[model samples]
Target: MSWFKQGLCFLPVFLVIWSSSTFIVTYLIALFRHDVDIIFPYISDTGANPPESCIFGLMTFISACAGTATIYARYKYVEKLSEDPKVVNPRLNKTAFLFGMLSCLGMCIVATFQETTVTVIHDIGALLFFVTGVLYIILQSVLSHRAYPFGSSMFVCRVRSGVAILAFLAFFPTVICAFFVTQTTLHRDKGDTDYPYHIASAVCEWIVAFSFICFFLTYIDDFKIFTLRVRVECKE
Candidate 1:
């Protein structure tokens, strides 16, 4: 295979690095500026200020684009395996694609709307991203299990399943704790009454985000073997 063709495998790798770097960079910026406290802050909190917010928005937008492409490529990969015309898996694969796109769209919304300024909309976007993102992974795991012989390895399937389970386990605590805490500003001081709840939610948020990133890393090997192509034909 051509180098460029094999490069598709790097999409997930790029996403994992890019998105994680976004969070780390923004957190460091916020920390250095003393805009946020030393304790854990929501991922959005790290990017709620001026310069960091701008960087957060731009990097997150890039992440969304990369994520969209990765999801679509995985969808096409499954469609290729469902070569049997009678197989009903294509419909399920399409559903997974829709969920993945919606998750990416949510990331776009989060990137565009700063949590401190438009908290409701930002929270909505976060909710959409987390909820739909989890659903997308669960569906893909199912498809991976079904496509065992034709596509993914048993090891990859099991790994994806494990990640999906971890993401699901983290999802509820993130949401529940977030509700218990009240958002007054971008940063939360340890002295705040809701500090415990805030920390819990923040930690869980990080877990879910990293889980999503880790799940994508499994795609590298799968993408290495397949070459996606476009065919053109003239009909008389």
Candidate 2:
């Protein structure tokens, strides 16, 4: 019933929406570049099963809905914050918001071009996305620690810290893998498949997968416990 509770309810919805948008945009880029066939078995053989355009378009729609939900949640959360008496760091929050927005923009631009043309701009955008992701992760780590009361919940603290560290470790491998994979795939037309490159690619793939698992497990556990607590508290 309180504004804080309302805002909390919206946080997950917002994250989901934001994540979906990124996924949709990425899907579109994959479709446009005709790389869909290489990555997807359903469409790899004939390039017909998923229907590049259709799949991307559907993903775009889904992403749009998610973006809308995120906007709604953010607006509500901001409104709730306005009622607080604490001095808000407008500068930091503004910087974070801008960084996040630019990151999304860069991601969308990169996705749009990943299919149509091979340009340095796309690469730059990809790099920007990587940098932005790192910044966001760091910001989140700091914010999470600042928000939670120290010593009030040791279990939660350890869990959060462990997740942060794992996520940080995962980022490096994933980013490196993404860069190498993009470069290698781009140069595939030139027929340059050295043994080390292949090995690097394989290692990168494994690292990326491991990093994703760490990230997913971290959030999944957090949310699962949070939801369980909510249910228990409600029943009581």
Q: Write the per-residue lDDT of candidate 2 for residues 103-167, one digit (tens) a residue.
A: 55655555454333445676676556545644544454444344444211445445545654664
What TM-score, over all chains together, does every model reach? 0.92, 0.51
Clash count, candidate 1: 0
Question: What does candidate 2 score in Cα RMSD to the true structure?
Answer: 9.6
Question: How many Å off is the CA of 151 in candidate 2?
Answer: 14
**Least accurate stretch of 10 residues (summed lDDT) in model 1?**
1-10
Candidate 2 stretches with Cα past 4 Å from truth are 1-50, 53-90, 150-164, 173-236
Q: How many angstroms is residue 85 displaced in model 1 relative to the true structure, after the best TM-score fit?
A: 6.1
Instruction: Identify the leading candidate in terms of TM-score.
Output: 1
Measured with C-alpha atoms, the lDDT of residue 9 in candidate 2 is 40
